[model samples]
Target: MELFAYYRSTSSYRVRIALALKGLDALVVPINLLSGEHRQPAYRAINPQGRVPALRTDEGSVLIQSPAIIEYLEECYPAVPLLSQSLVTRAHERAVAALVACDIHPLHNVSVLNQLRQLGQDEEQVAQWIGHWITQGLAAIEQLIGDSDYCFGSEPGLADVYLIPQLYAAERFNVSLAAYPRIARVAALAEQHPAFIKAHPANQPDTPT
Candidate 1:
């Protein structure tokens, strides 16, 4: 298996954490998003969406989108389950993961922020836009989450995988995590977990010095 990823990408980070938790190993192929490598013809052929974290499976299948990739991993390798078998609990976990990946993330991804700039928004204004959405999303997540060690329970699961990466993005953009103590606490605990430690952006081969 091969994973094409950009180290700092929140979406890619989610898959990395999932893979580590399942004790799966894949060749890391770094796609430098900052250098526009994803826009090139070769990468576009691999992933028509031209996104990071495209997984080339041992079966010669290519998977795109972080959520879909994670889902595939979950189905194929269920030993270390990231989701509960209970329908309700699974739905709840999926919702929490979607809250970050879908609602909060898309609004401020590189493409969207670049679009905002093209439409006459300055850098600071674009940053404010990112910060606003992240704050709003985290506030909602705080309300939904209980006083558990991870997002849904004592063990790290799907929501924790999603949350940790978003927190990394939040900290990178200077989004005020001070308002969400529950989130802060969960992320701090996740950092200490071996899987998460291995999946961190700083530990990735593509991370810039």
Candidate 2:
């Protein structure tokens, strides 16, 4: 298995954490998103969406998008289950993940920030744009986590991994985390889990660039 990724990409970080948690040995093929390599003809042929976190399966098929890839992983390797068996619990977990992936991540992605700059927005405004969405999203997450060690409880679940990278991204923008104590606590809990720790931006190969 080969996972096409950009180390600092939050979507890629999600897959990386899940793969690590499942003890899967997938090769990490880093894409240089800063260099626009993901949009180049070569990678575009592999994933037409031109996104990071594209996975090439053992059967030589390509899988795109974080949600689909993560679902496939949970199904194919069920040992270390990320989603709970309880129906309501699973739904709530999905809701929390969606709050970050669908609502928060899209607003603050690299492309969105670039578009803001293209529209004559300065760095300060760009930073504020990121912080605003994250602040709102984390406020919801704070209520969702509610002082739990993990987002869903003692065991790390899909919500925890999904939320951590976004928190890291928020940290990059110097977003104040003080308002969401529960979110902060959950992220701290994730740090103690090796799956989440290994996928941290600081631990990635391309971080210092």
RMSD in order of candidates: 0.9, 1.4
Residue 43's lDDT within candidate 1 is 97
Clashing pairs in 2: none
Worst 10 residues of 1 by lDDT: 84-93
lDDT of 1 by residue, 116-146 (tens): 9999999999989999999999999998877
RMSD of 1: 0.9
Best by lDDT: 1
User: lDDT of all predictions, in order shown?
Assistant: 0.92, 0.88
- Cα displacement (angstroms), candidate 1, residue 113, comes to 0.5
> What would the per-residue lDDT of candidate 2 be over residues 26-80, giving only the tens digit for each residue?
8888899989999999999999999999999999999999999999999999999
Q: How high is the lDDT of residue 78 in model 2?
A: 98
Residue 90 Cα positional deviation in candidate 1, in Å, after optimal superposition: 1.5
